[model samples]
Each structure stands twice: as structure tokens, then as C-alpha cells.
Target: MDRQDCQHLLAALGEYIDGTLDEELCREIEKHMAECENCRVVVDTLRKTIYLYRVEAQEESLPQEVRHRLLARLELEG
Candidate 1:
């Protein structure tokens, strides 16, 4: 986190966690995470949260109002 490049890492973090980042970029992120303990924790927590959300999402759908609100908040409404 102390490194200015942490911003670059953060920008690509979602793709990194999703396993969709290009190989060289992924390598850079991995190197940053190795040195930045704070970023590592943040990445780990987000990954776990996403995993749990996917699991719960499979078990039950959100009510329509809630779904709309959530999607709107995420700017993902389409």
C-alpha cells in the first residue's frame, strides 16, 4: 500500500481476483501483493466476500426492489 503502484494494483484488482487479467499484469499484481501486506488483506477479504456472495446468490434470489436498489447503487442497472 505504501507504494504508489498500489493504485495501479487496485485498479486491476477486480480482474486479478476474477482471474481475467493478462499474465504480465497479473505478475505485477502478485509482486505488489507480496510486498504490501495491507493490499494482500484487502484482496483476500474481497475474494472471500465475493465467494460467499456467489454461494448465497445461488441459494436465493433478491427481491425485486432490493435487487433494483442494489444494482442501482452499483451502477449496474441495465
Candidate 2:
């Protein structure tokens, strides 16, 4: 797949993770991820982020340093 395909995959990633996508589409994504290291890393990071919010961060905001680091990593820091 080309860069455009990766963008398309990334666009659908949230739905893929939320289990809102069709099984066939999910299979396509998983197949793509299996061969794409960049996509795999993105998917893993997103999954962990979701897990953290649902499990750990649900009780409170992310620890201050973590929030700052995440924001910086996204280049969203002020």
C-alpha cells in the first residue's frame, strides 16, 4: 500500500478499535497492520491510549507529566 492507503487506514482506525466497523473491514485492517510496521505502531499506541482512558484515566485525569508528554508528542504543546 502507498502513503494514501495508510492515511485511509488511519482514518478508519478509531471505528476499527471501537468495534463499530464491519467484520470484513476489520479483517482488512488487521491484514494491513500485520504487514505494516508503522501502522502496527499507530494501532498499538491508540489501543493503549484507549485502554488507559477506559481503565486508569477514568478515575482521574492522566498524571500531569504523562499529559504533558503526550501533548508534546503530538506537537500540541503550547
User: TM-score of every model?
Assistant: 0.70, 0.65
Largest TM-score belongs to which candidate?
A: 1
Worst 10 residues of 2 by lDDT: 53-62
Expressed as tens digits, the lDDT of each residue in 1-78 for candidate 2 is: 367768879889889988999998898889888889999898899899878878975677568999999999999999
- Which tens-of-lDDT digit does each residue in 38-70 have in candidate 1? 999999999999999999889996789998999
lDDT of 1 at 78: 100
Model 2 bad stretches (over 4 Å): 58-78
